[model samples]
Target: MSYSIVVDHVSFGWPDGTTVLDGLDAAFPAGRTGLIGVNGSGKSTLLKIIARELVPGSGSVSVSGEVGYLPQNVPLGAGRTVSDLLEISATRAALHAIEGGDAAEEHFAAVGDDWDVEERARAELDRLGLDHVGLDRTVGTLSGGESIMVALAAQLLKRPEVLLLDEPTNNLDLDARERLHAAVGAWQGVLVVVSHDRALLELVDQIAELRDGAVRMYGGNLARYEEQVAGEQEAAARLVRTAEGEVRRQARELVETRIKIDRNARTGRKAAENNRVPKIIAGARKRQAQVTAGRQRALAVEKLEEARERLNEAEQAVRDDAEIRIQLPGTEVPAGRTVLTLPLARAAGDDEQVAGVGGKVLETLVVRGPERIALLGPNGSGKTTLLKRIVRQGAQVPVRYLPQRLDLLDDRLSVLDNVRAVAPSASVNDVRARLARFLFRGDRANQAAGTLSGGERFRATLAALLSAEPPPQLLLLDEPTNNLDLASVRQLSQALSAYRGALIVVSHDLPFLETIGITRRLRQDRDGGLAES
Candidate 1:
């Protein structure tokens, strides 16, 4: 079969001797490939290597055709416009037109020999759902989601033979993510996508899991991979149990034999005081001792060998089960009557009039103590906007909002400084202790928030929000599960379950929501009206 890209014995390591990928070999074909793994499992690093942004320390990567890449966070050049970025291609084409460059034939085929390139560019922008985004608009002025879409559109215009995308759905809402996924699904070229979204995985032709510095391709969807993992884990557990039982049995037998040898030796020594008969007995006792010793040695060797084998097997069984660690501290404050009430809350339209309004009037939505409520809805359904409004209206109640985007944090500040700034009165020792609770201990706390990985930054933000003096009687989280590894998500869920306050979370992860005990459902309509479901 023909391959678009091939990696032969590729190996990479950081300057600090941390091996990210080791002797990995894989081939990407002309179809969607979903790359799934833990947070730090080298998915992004491998993508970077394929994009030529980072060179591997060893091995070789061969590509059959041109490559287009969309990085995790698209860095828009300072003051650059959409037209400025896209016009470069047009300029190159015009130059090619004058000099009869190699690509001139392809350009003429795509557009007529005298076709208006500006019209084609505008049409491309519209096709990518950026019709309203003027070519003159500064890239900096665009939202995170908008910028990502535009970057993708730019790559699509290139019509490369292969495309590499790293967490393209990171900051996108439901609508935008769906649109992007559709565009990718329709592409007729080699596509490699690294993402954690299960919905996105369904669009891929094959799923490749990156774990333990190697890529293993599974011939199925995410659901099938999950089923396989579950079966493997069960098998591993059974093997471990059987091995443990065998070890225990061997230990008991060894102990019994040792005791029997000691007793026989004591009896033989007492009888040695007799005559010739006693000497014969002594000889027999010595022989028995040697036999017992041999048995014991054999048993010991067998036990050791069995244990080593079992350990190796167990390690392999659970190699992919690493979890993230996130601890959200709880406040000591007791919940009050009606933790939050939005009576006839509404947002005005562009004309300064109530575009659409609705009311949820109850005597009290009492969260007596430690009540966890999850807000569920589709994309652009106002889940986040509702949380923000609640925090604003309930100002008297100490509340902390952890936005999906951590942009509110100052990237220049150290993790410690960021936490300290949140609670200025907190002493350095106290701040350090709090940061440690969130897994940012020792020198990690001193690292800049910008330098921390996505998971680390998320934990730091949570630690800062939960470390206040009054300890926020209410916690407002917007898609807190995004970018977090499975382990960290579990840790946060456990902590929130134990919290003695109110929790209002916005998330699309149904399993996580169920784990946290979200009992209420809220739905928003196209007319901007909110209704309890």
Candidate 2:
């Protein structure tokens, strides 16, 4: 099959000597591919290498044609305009100069037959639902979602033969996410994206999984890839069971052989002492028997070791994603309890100042019981602000909020210390035990919170939140799945499953919301009204 991108025996490491990819090789055909792995698996680093934003320590990367890359975190430089981001400012300037009758050779040279750069840029922006964003507007003036869409639009306008995107759907609202997914689905060139956005991944032609320092390709989209992995895991599990039985049998036989040899030795010794045969002959027989027993024991021990080795190999075949297994505070807000009450309309009073939910009959936002609510809204719709207001005024129960930026943890503190800070009543051992459930075991728990990878930080932040002293009876999460890898998303969902509190999570990840068992869906409309969908 023809390939548009080829990575050959690539290896890379950070300046701190932390190894990322090692002798990695991968090839992408002229179709979209979903690149997925746990956080810290080098997904972003690999994309950077392919984009030539970072040089690999060894090997090389070759692309079929011009490459366009949209990094996960778009650098929103202050005072940089959208035209600058699109890289069409010069052409636009030249076009305007020519329109003004400045017959400069440099202007003509800069135009380079791209006189319609402005129109094309606008069209691309409109395609990505960025029509609301002006080309001359500074990036800093745009919302996070708007900036992402603009960055994506910049890459799309290049129309390069190869495109690389890292977490392109991050911070996007539902509308923006749909638009991005549509754009990705229509991509014709070699497109590869590193993202936990399941909807975007579902549009890919293949799934490339990065794990254990290697890349493995599967011949289908996210759902199909999951099916294939599930089948493989099932078969691997069967092999493990079979290998375990063989190891047990080998161990039992080894024990029996040793017992029999000991019995024989005792019998021979007793015979020699009783002088059943000449002592010299008995001694020779005993010596010969001892040699035979030694040889037998060695053979048995070898077989047992071989069986154990096979068992280990079989177990290795099973993928253990380091799933987080944690129990949230068992504090359940009663079903009839009024966890939070907010007048969403602008009319009520001081407490309801942060009001307005689209057109739904939600004149007042009243959250009761341990209801898991999915907060859906467009960019600039005030979802995050609403979450903050809830913390400030609404929630009657003990509450905690995890912001979208995940800046809750104290960077200087160790993970254990961070958790301890929130749950001071709990013993250090208790916090350590809880952190272990989040996969921060032993020394990992002692690492400074600032040193954690995206996934680790999320887990650590979550551990601290749930381990709060009084235990949150109402939890608010803003874009909780942002920057998380697929497995990390799963781990987050697992952690939330044990949370016995009312939750209001703002996110565009529909599949994630479904996994967390959201009981209700609330959308904040651009008109500042809250509606229940």
Candidate 3:
């Protein structure tokens, strides 16, 4: 039984001295392994270390064979065609042919006499669900989902011994996700995938949990891991309560013993002259002293035990309650009869004289109070385009738009400054206080917006959006759950559910949409139009 990959006591930290993985030990065989953790829990970092992109500060990582890594975001080289990348193998064969080495005939034979590398490349593309994509097509022209498929096809062509994927399902539609899942399930190699998708985790044979700079393995899927966590949390809470009660009882007993000792010492001194009384009192004092000392020692031991138990309980509870950080300011205003109304066949202007018209996307849309609408569609299917058009048409209504990217924020400004900038008329102190409510307290408020984590950035954006004077009656979220941890996503879902305003969200997270009460869905057609179903 040979191991595909082995990580022995590996520790890693960023150049900025932020420690992530510590004393982590794990081994991977020829099967699927799911890595689950909270945001900033070092899932990506650990994967990179395995891929040899990042070196560990301590310990060692050993790989038995070639490793293929798929980054979260595929970076395509400019002007590179699918055939150009694939032809590298052919080029190596050609080099062997020119050198006339001992293995030249073998290389030529393996590549075939005619060496139709283009045909082989096309077949590989078809295998990865890119049958429509041309072999000569530039990677730059591909959509987000298509680009991911192309990258995957390139890797599969080489057939590495182990594959490392980070959030591979992100940005993919339901159909594309299913296709990728099938492709991965069929692969014959070691797989280490870092993702929050519960559905995807079901395909894995084992799950590894990363928490507090350590990794632990469990033999099951995400559902089973969640069940185990829930059980541990309940047990930890019970232990904590029990320890607290015992501590309280011991404290009371110690106090009573001290009081009795004081009373006995006073009584012993007062009855010094009485013969029988003095003898009895002296014995009482001796016994009282012994009892007091013993009680003190016992209390110390009990306190130590209780402290250790409480610490263990606290750690377990932290693992159990994985909550996302999302807090929107409460609004007293009720949603109006029509939160948004769009015109039929409206022209969305682009550089080339109105690149498209709204038909399936928007043919007279109207949203009512407290209605959760999910804007579901493929990449470049006008989800964000429809959102912008609605916002422009519904200017009369108070709206809060959280864009997918935080490019709307000023990077140079502090988190507090950004919040204050959103509503300059408000006092700085008041804005800072509001920010603190979102967990940006004290010095954190002074930190630059650029330095904040993905979760913190979303919180800052939310703070800015909610700080408006009249408050927003309609909330527009564009991929709001993207790049957020499971905990943060849950918090955002709960916060949105609590909001009285209407919600118009465009997201790829089906689970999040279902949780946020999206009763209506907007899907886009292949011809750049939306269809409401």
Q: State which candidate has the highest TM-score.
A: 2
True-structure RMSD, every candidate: 6.4, 3.0, 5.2
Clashes of 2: 7
Report the C-alpha displacement of residue 201, candidate 1, in angstroms: 1.8
lDDT of all predictions: 0.73, 0.88, 0.74
User: Tens-digit lDDT track for model 2 on 396-493?
Assistant: 88989998888989999999989988888898788889889988899999999989988889999988888887889999999989888888889889
Q: Which residue pairs collide in model 3, if any?
A: 323-487, 324-487, 324-488, 360-530, 361-529, 361-530
Error of 2 at 221 (Å): 0.4
Candidates sorted on TM-score, descending: 2, 3, 1
Order of quality (lDDT):
2, 3, 1
Model 2 bad stretches (over 4 Å): 273-281, 326-329, 344-363, 441-443
Per-residue lDDT of 378-435 in model 1, one digit per residue for the tens? 4555677777777777744577888888765679999999988878988999898877
Steric clashes per prediction:
2, 7, 6
Local error of candidate 2 at residue 400 (angstroms): 0.1
Q: What's the lDDT for candidate 3?
A: 0.74
User: Whose lDDT is greatest here?
Assistant: 2
Following a full C-alpha superposition, what root-mean-square deviation does model 2 have from the true structure? 3.0
C-alpha positional error of residue 42 in candidate 1 after TM-score superposition, expressed in Å: 1.7
Per-residue alpha-carbon lDDT of candidate 3 for residues 167-205, written as tens digits (9 for 90 to 100) = 888777666777788887787789999887767888888
Q: Which residue runs does candidate 3 get wrong by more than 4 Å?
A: 85-117, 273-336, 344-362, 392-394, 408-417, 423-448
